[model samples]
Each structure stands twice: as C-alpha cells, then as structure tokens.
Target: MWLLLALVLLLVILALEMLRFVRNMRTIPGPLPLPLLGNAHLFLGLTPAEACLRMGELAEKHGDTFGLFLGPSYSVMLFNPRDVERVLSSTQLLTKSEEYSFLGRWLNEGLLVSNGRKWHRRRKIITPAFHFRILEQYVEIFDRQSLRLVEELKLRRSRGHAGVNLGEAIHLCTLDAICETAMGVSLNAQTNVDSEYVQAVKTISMVLHKRMFNILYRFDLTYMLTPLARAEKKALNVLHQFTEKIIVQRREELIRSGKEQEASTKEDVDDVGAKRKMAFLDILLQSTIDERPLNNLDIREEVDTFMFEGHDTTSSALMFFFYNIATHPEAQQKCFEEVMSVVGQDKSTPVTYELLNKLHYVDLCVKETLRMYPSVPLLGRKVLEDCEINGKLIPAGTNIGISPLYLGRREELFSEPNSFKPERFDVVTTAEKLNPYAYIPFSAGPRNCIGQKFAMLEIKAIVANVLRHYAVDFVGDTSKPPVLIAELILRTKDPLMFKLRERVY
Candidate 1:
C-alpha cells in the first residue's frame, strides 16, 4: 500500500508539471523539450558563440526564431539578421543582461555592463574620449609600441629562436598601451613583460569569462557555499588590488603635476603609446552623469573594466591576424604588398590614419579573421519589457542571444562562408547581399565597442611593423581549423605556432 501511494504521488507531480509545460509551450517555436531541462542543454560543451551558431542552425532547421529554457531561465534566440538588427540597435525591445553577478561586482556600472538611462549617459560621456581627431593624436602611442615590439623581435632574431610568441608580444604591447592611455601610468609591460599585474589581469579576465556561462553561479545563495565562488571572489580581490594601485598612484601623480589636458607632446608615453593629453582615467574621473562626479569605487570599476576591454580584444585580434597571414600565403602577400606599397620599408616612419584607412585589403583581412573567430563570441540582451519578435510573443524577463559568430558563418549569408577568403569581401561581391548587420565583428548597435577606433589603429600599426621586419612562415599545419575556446573572446586552446624568417628586402 505504501509503495503504491509513493508511485501515485510521483505520477501526480509529473502530471501537474506536464500540464504547466504544455500551457507554457503555446507561444514559441522550438523542439520538443524534456521536463525541466528545455532546449538549453543543447549548448553543453560548446562555447557560447558555437552554441549560438548551433541555435541558428536549429532555427534554419526548424525556421526563424526558437525558444530555449536555460534550466528555468527562458530566452529567445534571434538568428535572422533583420531581427538581430532590431534587438541590438533598438532601445525598445531589449537591454544588456546582468548574467554575471561577479562581473556586476567587478565592472560596477560601466558602459559595457550598464543599461537604461545610466548606459546612455555613460556612453555619451565616453564617446568624446575616442573621437577620430583624438585618435590621430594617439598615433604616437601606437608608434612607440610598434617600435618596442620590433626591437624585441630584433632581440629574438639575434638570438635565433624559431619564433617569438607573437601573441605574448602583442599582449604586452596592448597592456602597456591600455595602462598608459586608460590608467594614465606606463606599466612598461612591453619591456618588463612578466609583471604580476599583467599576469593578474589575464587571470582575472579568464576567470571572469569562465564565470559568465556557469549556471549554478547565478544563484546568490549557492555562491556562498561553493568552492569555485570563493576562488572567484579571491581572484577578484587580486585584480581589484592591482588596478586600484595603478589608479590611486596615477591620480596622485596627475594632481601633483597640475597637467590635466591633452595639450602635451608625444613624449608623454614614456613606455609606449604616449602623447595623449589625457590619461583615460582622468577623463573618466572628471566625467559626470547629470553633473554628479563619479565616486572612487565607480571610477575604479570603470577603469579596471576598460583596461581589460582595451587590451585583451586588441591583442587577441593581432595574434589571429598574424596566424591568418602566416597560413594564407597569397592573402598575406597581398596584404604585405599593400602595406609595403603604401607605407613601406621603415619602421620609424609612423603609420598615419589616412594610410591605415587606405589599406582596405588589411581591413578586409581583419574583418574576415574576426568573422571566423570573433573576439567576443556571444552577446546576451534581456528583454526590458514584454516584446514581440518575428510576431512571436516574447515575454518580459527573457534573455536574447545575438551572436555575430553564427551570422558570419551562414551559408546563405556568404558563399563558401566557412572558408578563409578575404577576397570574398571585395567591393562588388559584398554589395550583392548587403545587409550591414550580417558581418558584425565589432557588433552592430548603439552599444558597439567604444574603443573600435583605437583597436583598429593599433592592429594596423602592428601588422605594418611586423611585415616590415619578418616574413611569417608556419611551422606545421597552420591550415588546420583551430579549436577556439570562446569565453569573453574566442581564443585558441593551443598556441598558433610559426617559424619566423626575417625578410631582408
């Protein structure tokens, strides 16, 4: 009798759940979902970008948009370029999701993570910091870093190593650039190369990225009992301490010097990327939202957030650019020809903004590279209010995953899309399927990356400097499709190795 009663009770619970599931299933188009789990399990083991791509494939398989339940957290995956444009650009439909509790803790309320009125205001304030004229003023900063990198390569050339870790070199250069430009102090990361601050920054970012997808982490209650949560908090502490020291010291130094303007010489970048009339921190320090100055904590979070954002994305981009150039001889040769022809033979002669812009092929190459391996693989925007997408009734409190990673690889979007062919991006062919949102490497929206100008300039400078010194040669099968681990950005599980041969032209 007891056994029978237990079975009956279980059946009753199952039946009630089934009824609720059926009722909830009325609105969206998706595969038959298992009780409790939903379609979210389909993303297991995949990077968020790859998971997003899988969702697109499923959408094409099933048609248009689909419903996924991340355990109980419901989200609608938007794959159509038109739909993506609406959600990403429109303030009406969606807002930045606060998935990472720790990120909110670490980044505070900076532009990348902030939303609504605050995001709008902060984005406007930070906009002036990245203007074209201001970037042109930042040219020497790019120059100094490139020079330091070349000088380092020369050291390796003299020592006769198979190849220096270009990824490591680029990392240091961008770190120094970010520190000086954003934090207002030169870490001299390019020369020191192994500073604890540098190591801590990378660790914190990697940890932070790891934390993004972790579901159990979302519950505030579970975090208190979890070992991973404790370690994450500890890691955050290290990163906070690192950036705080830089911020406090730099602010003091600036106040003492009494120089608070961008009216200085290129000599400002003592380490590299110098001559900025402003430390990026100073601008943000003086930044006001509705005329209220940012507090110390607010300022620290913004600066720490920007430092990681400014450095990692740009450096990883350059690393992939080298990997692609090394693998594709014809493409690399074309890029080399363009760089050589326009601004050639001398590393000391700075690459100007006009000349960098003129290197359309290089631009296309970076675009192509990013499409294949996007720096930020996935973006999540949660619905601020109840909305309709593709005429489907999407409820409030739903997360929407908008991924360029999937959009770039669609067979319908580009002919032979999986192939690494920068040539496809040439003017005539590109105009045929001209949805501007289809190829959103930096993303397409009002909330697009603020430092896009600075990133590109630095990348172009590095490529020009690199090609001028050495002709890249792959040590092994650089053609093999790399396994990219997409966390905050898509990065390789292994080093993209090569044998560097000095070009004596």
Candidate 2:
C-alpha cells in the first residue's frame, strides 16, 4: 500500500514536468528551463530588460523567436524584427499578457490596459479629448511652466557648478502639463517641489511602481510575507483618500456653479465645468456607449491610469534626452543652433508651435533618443489561440515578449545602432527606411500610445526653452551613464546627475 501511494506521488510530479512545454507546440525554440522555476534562474543577476536582452542574444543565435517559462508565466519572446512585426500587428490571435496582473489592480478597464469591448469603447470615448485641436490648445500651458525650470537652474549655475539633477525638475514640468491639460488644475512644480499635491502624486506613484515586483504580494495566506506589500497598501489608501477628496471638492465646486447657472437661466442643466473636473476625469466621467455609463470607480481607474502613464513615459524619454545631449556637446550645440535658427537668436520670447516646428534637427534628435532608449522597454502579449510564427507553433497562454530596445540597437537593423546618431531619422521618403517596428518608442499597431503627440510636443518645447536659457554639462562622471533599470519603463538606477553651465553665447 505504501509503495502504491509513493507511485501515485511520483506520477503527479512527472505530469507537472510534461506540462512545462507542449512538445506538439511548434516550439519557436529557447534555452531549456528547470522545472517549476523555468527560465527564472537566468534572471538571478539581471533586471527584466537586461535579462530579456540576454535571452534575445541567445535567441538570435538559436532562432528568431523562442519560448520562455518563468514559473507558470510562459511566453514566446519575439527576437527578430520580422517576428515582432507579426505579433504586434496581428492582434486577433494575440492579446495583452497576463503578466500585467499587478498593473491591472489599479487600471480596471482603462484604455491603455483593458481588452476587447471595454477597451474599444474607452478608446473611442477618449479619442475626441486628444483631438489635435483640443491638445494644441494646451501647448502654451506646457511652455508657461517649462520656463520655471530654466529659471530655477539659472540660479543654481551662477557659482560655476556643473549641473543640477534635472529628473525631478522635468517630472514637475510634465506633471503641470498633464494636470492643466487633463484636470484643469494649475501647478508649476518646476519652481516648487514642496507643493502638497505634487508631493502626494510623486509619493503615491513611487509606491505603486515599487509594489509590482514584490513576490510576497502574490501570496494571500501570509501577512508577514512581505512588508513591501503593507507599505504599498498604506500608500494606495492615502492616494485613494487624497484623490476622493479632490473629486469631492471638484464636485462641490461644480454644484455651486450649477446652482448659479440655474438661478441665472431659470432652467435646470448640468454645470459644464462641474460635470467634469478636467480632461483626465472628463474622459471617463462624460463617457457612455449605447447607454452603458461608467461608474465613479470606473472614472477613478481611468484617471489613475492616465495620470501614471502620462508622466512616467515622457519623464523616461526626457531623462535619456538630457543625458544624451549633455554627453554629446556637439549634438547639444547643433540642437541650440537648430533652435536659434528657428527662433532667430531670441532669448526673451517663449516658444510657439511655429517655432517648435522649425527645429527639425531637434525633432530628429528626440526620435533617435527614443529609438535607442524607448520609454517602454518591453511590450508583451499572450497567445489567445494556438498560432504559427515564422513557421513555428506558439501555444495558448504563451507570453510573447518583444523589445524595441533590442531591435533598435541591433547591428543588423541600424547603421550604427548603438551609436548616437540623429541623422538616421532624416530620410525624406517613408519607403526608403528601416522597418518602422525597429524604432517604435511609442510602440506601434492599433494599441500604440494615444498621448504620444502630446508628449513629443511638451518635450520639444521644454528642450528648446532650456537651451535658449542655459547649456547643460556633466559635473561628475560622464564616463559612466546611468545603469538601466526596467520597471514599467526603463529608468536610471541612480538620479542622472550632471553640471549646468550658463551659455555665454
């Protein structure tokens, strides 16, 4: 009887091993993974992006696409440009990965992360909000606050210091831009970091970013399993309470305005400003598809999703932008020339759309930076049905990973893929070009970033304004760039520091 019981246990273990890789699955090909843990052991000393790069190198040698099982998190990573193009463009058989389980807790069914009908509806509803006419109206609002940073650094560089840490400053500028355009709130964080709302926004965002990777958060039975989870809960609670308070205040303000309107017109109707606090809330608050109205919690989810994705991606691009420009004085000088050429040696005047448009080289510089260090490091999807890629069978639940970071840097793709070269974007015709997928900083296909135009506009304005005022230089170690750490996006592990020098020109 004891022998029979042992036999049954052994059979169970064997069954689990068999399920690791479906042999009938076309097997794009990948390094063999250990049981239960799969390829997780490969990530022992690497960030997720670094690990993906390492895996990508292995895949290039072995095959264009390959499968990896990190625990039950199985996904085929597309290493070749061809494979990535197919997976990203063909959304029918592939859907967003289940790995985003953590991010989903806050997003609900927001446009950026939701699926199918809900995603379609939200996308349709929010499309009008970002219409060029509406977004163009906010560019001046972006420029107004960007000057605050240039002014702050002006004071810091008077003593012959190298540079001020610009990460937080840039974040402030973007925060103000997003706030004013979306929520109709006014904040100039470039000049003041101590603002209650700014601090709360930053703290809560930091806490959320820090929570996604805590393995202990995965366990339900263990309270003492991870202190990180507890801290995250506290942060989330505070953020929700804070957001609700703001929502309530906006509601009351709207109510009073509504009452005044009713008294004046002698008729009843919802307050235009009161019905929605800002564009961020307005997108969801005013949404309806065939009479399916979004609830307040639904509104909360969408607002938070926009708030997070809005500042984070732009901040990543800007940080890398400054770091790149600071290191390459030639590039920075060229950018200044480009800006001055457009603005005509003007220092006192603020940048406008026409002026921003004139800096074509600067636009190329931004594109090149994004190609090398894309804001979103890794994009993932899951196989909804058994699918074939590059003549290989990819099974369902397989997480397909692709990185613009690697594709953009491949020697086979770009001339000097690793080198900083803005001229790569100077091609006059779209036909005479590299695979568009090879340089997707804002991703590609139907689900690419909706706010990309808004982000680029803000970035160009800020860069032009900063150069018009001051020239950036590295104070300490220009020899070593910030080590890349992959979270929701690629971030510098340390605060990217450099010295700022006032341009005597």
lDDT of each: 0.72, 0.69
Give residue 9's error in model 2 in angstroms: 14
Residue 209 deviation, candidate 2, in Å?
5.0
Candidate 2 per-residue lDDT over residues 1-505, each given as its tens digit: 8657755665465446447564633445677776655566776666644754576577676665667655435667675777777877775843577656556655666676788877777777776666555555566776787887777666656743545777767887788777667666665666667876676666555545554443323323332246755655665665566556655565556456664223221012123333432355544444556765555676667676777788878888988898889889999999998888887676767787667777888998899899888988888887877778877777766777788877887888888786788887888733337888787788778788888878888899889888887788765587765667666677876777767766665
RMSD per candidate (Å) reads 5.7, 5.3
Residue 37's lDDT within candidate 2 is 55
TM-scores of the candidates are: 0.85, 0.85
109-188 per-residue lDDT for model 1 (tens digits): 77778777877877877776776666775666777778788887777656656556777778888888887777767788
How many clashes in each candidate? Answer: 3, 12
C-alpha displacement of 460 in model 2, angstroms? 0.6
